[model samples]
Target: MKVNIPWVVGLTIAALGAAGLGGQTARVPGSDADPASCAAGSGRITIATGNSTGVYYVMGGALARLVNGHTDVRAGAAETGASVQNIRQLVAGDYDVAFSLADAADAAVRGTSPFGEPQKIRTLGRIYPNYTQIVVRADSGIRTVADFKGKTISTGSPLSGTEAIATKLIDAAGLDELDVNRQRLDLTKTVDGMKDGSIDGLVWSGGLPTSALTDLYTTLGSEDLRMIDPTPLLPEMKKKSAVYDTATIPKATYDLPADVPTIAVPNVLLVRDDMPANLACALTTLVYDNRQALGAAHPAGKDIRVDEADRTAPIRLHPGSERALAGLTSR
Candidate 1:
């Protein structure tokens, strides 16, 4: 049974140099220069997004369209390894904006492991939440994390928020990384593995109704696939980071028998601390103002609400984003 995933149609929508802004100064953020004086110049900018099948990629495309249609910024969304990598490249000036998981963003700003030194980054705003989806073959007899000791599992792409949470969840379950055969594959490959019985399970942190998983369920059905409740590790997960919370994946999301309980982490759109104030302001406003259009692309976009946009903490909001939000809420 072949399923057509609409989102993958134009996967590589635009290249980093697609907008042709060579030689000229790229609007790379993170400098001590006064953001107020920097004009919102007309040029191409890249957005670092996640796996092609994940919500970040879908929403990133939608965002790029919004920016292009409404502002002077010529935006392009690139598929990346997600959170950790996105933040790293965003700092290096490879990309102007990035979508990152809150926990990873917190680690980046605090100079924690996986990050060599503290980074100077600021949030456009908190967008949606990522629910940890742990799916196992019903025939694999993997009832809990402990059962994963001898089974093969896909832990998500390296340097991704999915990998970070997968590792923490395994540790919280009292299993060493050596206990399981870990595979670091992206969602597309992981789904392929699941289809062929080469992979026993997969741990993915993504938005509800992730296109890849939807494809998986559509092809494999409930008789062969199932999601596990990992809420038991919430206390342990929270001990390491306050950002960890519990969320439910409604049975309807993938047509399961019942709701699945899992760990949740908020996602944020990050930009360098030194981004021009006006550019940041315009981008932030464009997102909220065109919320309906973004939502039309993916359900996750609807979750990006104005009321919850400024909830990003630890990582300060960009001054321009703050100005945008201030004006938005006041009206």
Candidate 2:
């Protein structure tokens, strides 16, 4: 079955752009000069996404299309390893925008997550909520976090936000990160391991109803698979930062027994603090104005709203974003 990305990404609505898609220069309006101004140019803007199976990749691509369609700017989306990689490249000027998780975004701003120093990233807006999903085969006998004492598990890839969430979830579940058999693999390999029983469990954090996850659930069937609810430990998670909260993955999403309580984190659109202001303003304006068109392509894009542009974590809004938020700009 063909899953519609734009319709199912968010509980509220739409998503946007981020990294390694290709080389993205700038498509500035011919009139843009003042870094704080919005004008015109003809070039390219690149957005970094995440693991191909995750919502970030789909939504990021849709956002790039939306920007290219709505604004004078030409844009493209690149598939990336996700938040950590996206943030690092975004600051290095390898990318103009990136899709990042709030936790990593917070960590980057405060110089916490995977980076050793404070990053210069700024926010475009809060796009969507990522649900922490832990899937395990019924035969694994992993009823609780502690039950996975020596079981093989996929903790996600390095330099990806999935690893960050997996580590924290393992901690919150009262398990030792080192005690579990950890395999840091990407989505494709993780699914393969789970199917073959080489991995007893796997952790993935992404927008509701991840495509790879849907495949996992369908292949595993109800008798062989289940989700581990992590909401009871939310208080412990919040201690790490305010970026995490309670989220529910409806039974209808993966055909689970019920809504599984889990940790919720927001997805953010990011740019360098020094990004051209006019471009920022124009980009921000294009998103809010053309959200419907975007939503038609990726459900997560429905969440991109100028009114809520300041919802990003500890990161500050770009000057252009601020102007757009205040209704004084377009992009």
Candidate 3:
């Protein structure tokens, strides 16, 4: 039930530095001054992360610190709705790099629903898998996605990857948009709603041990809350997109009684296709080289492996990232 105070403090300082609100520079751990190895480009860049309490925000903060300390590029992380919004803003030139679910990125590249036309986006690489977590109030009498009818559910922030998945899950369960009372709220608000009994359930796609969910489980206790398994809709979900897979949320993550079965999606680091290759290459290098430091910020960071990094399919790997991977693998 204890919070990670150091990680919180680190994120705060990084946020302040990124916003230019701090007078003194805080030294980032594991930073280096080797410009040649740090890539050959220098500029200020911004990373689009997800809701404040999610893993994207934590990882993005770590990435910003890594970039600022080791590379010539000064970096900052902005909290957004995730995936759908990240890609939109990344292409709009609002962010230099972004975190997104593979499904949304694929939709962006193919110009699928939620996107009117093919987007000119590319990937740095795949980082980690996001587990789809659906939780309901134990007293709500909700047993499955089918029981969602007439129940108020938080489908995640508007235009977020969580919302996209939530929609797919609902449809796969043969429910219409109007069948359930859908509330489009961010993780923070969704947690509040669940606690207040104003919300019966929620659909969230995030890294394991999400701070917001952790707080919820800690405050509400198991007797008041329960996790639901949506793998029953997996075959239907895969028919729509191949990004989903079966995974488990170990009880240790939140001290539940047992592992929770769920669907999983890979998350990718994305950028515009026109980004300078040298800069992209540099950023990719920083991510892998500082994996340990990133993991220190969040356990999800350790899942970012070089071998699995270039697995971003459908969404083409950025040329710069390809070059960085090539160099990394050859060594």
Candidate 4:
């Protein structure tokens, strides 16, 4: 998507280049500027979101619109593989803001496997939680992760948080991914593959009422589609990463016969460490102030509480974001 910078954002950029009223530089290039001193900070930014059918895509678009329409900064969102890929691209300077799973964000900051070294990233805030959905055909006989050994399964797009969690779940259950016919596919193709019997099951991590999952259950009917409980592996998963939490897929969500137990992970918005404090503050405040419009865009936005907005730990919060959050409380 394209977002044209408003005259205000362009003007702010120009203003930041000039001397201040006190004869001091308005802002030193490439240095973090005080939020109070740089109220007019503005520029164009791209937000890396997830699959087209996912909640991140919807909420990200909403956020981009808010930034462009309300703030001095102009922004747009792009569809990506989600989480891991978003972090990598953000660090590589392909994007300015990124939506990522909290676990992946932690791994990136800690210099884990996918990331060769610690990435210089900071969080704007936590957004929402993603429920891990493991859907299977009723007759697939996939009672547990181990049952997937000889069966075909979709593990989400490569480098996505879904794939990362799926791999962890399989290993937690003492099953090797190599033993399963793991197909790396997106939500749309995975749903189609399940319907056509091309695959037996698929694992997905997404917000409640995930559009693609809803379509799967509606098209296949309860008897044809079943959700396997992954709660059994929670202990082991938490051992590897503390980000795993217990979550439920309520019957009302997909009209299922019962609530399904699953693992959940929080999602976060990230930016490079060098992002100006003023821009981060403006972006963060915009999301909080116009949250209702965001909720209108995607119900998941309801989970974006100001109280929880500053709870991005393990990954440090940007100074600008902290200032924005502070203003929320003072008001």
Question: In lDDT terms, which candidate is top?
Answer: 3
lDDT of each residue in 184-269, candidate 4, tens digit only: 99989999999999999999999998999888888998888889999999999998778889989899888888999989999999
Task: List CA RMSD, all candidates.
Answer: 5.1, 6.5, 5.8, 6.1
lDDT of 1 by residue, 255-292 (tens): 99999888899999999987888788878888888889
Across residues 1-331, which tens digit of lDDT does each residue of candidate 3 receive? 2223222212333465657746865433213333334353555667889999999999998888777777555677888889999999889877778999999998999999999999999999999899999999999999899899999999999999999999999999999999999999999999999999999999999999899999999999988998999999999999988888999999999888899899999999999987767777888887887889989999998888899888887999988789899888787
Off by over 4 Å in 4: 1-34, 37-40
| Candidate that scores best on TM-score | 1
Lowest-lDDT window of 10 residues in candidate 1? Answer: 1-10
Better of 1 and 4 by lDDT: 1
lDDT of each: 0.86, 0.77, 0.86, 0.83
Residue-level lDDT tens digits of model 2 in 1-331: 2223232222110122232323444244323555655553445567888888888878777776666555555566777788899899888876778888889999999998578999998987777678888889999998766676899988887878989988887787788887899899999899999999899998899877788988988898867997988777788889987889887888998899888888888888898887777777777776676678766766656656655567775888888888877873333
Candidate 4: deviation at residue 126, Å?
Answer: 0.8
**Could you estimate the TM-score for every candidate?**
0.91, 0.86, 0.89, 0.89
Task: Tell me how many clashing residue pairs each candidate has.
Answer: 0, 30, 0, 0
lDDT of 1 at 142: 95
Which is the better candidate, 3 or 4, if ranked by lDDT? Answer: 3
Stretch of 10 with least lDDT, candidate 4: 7-16
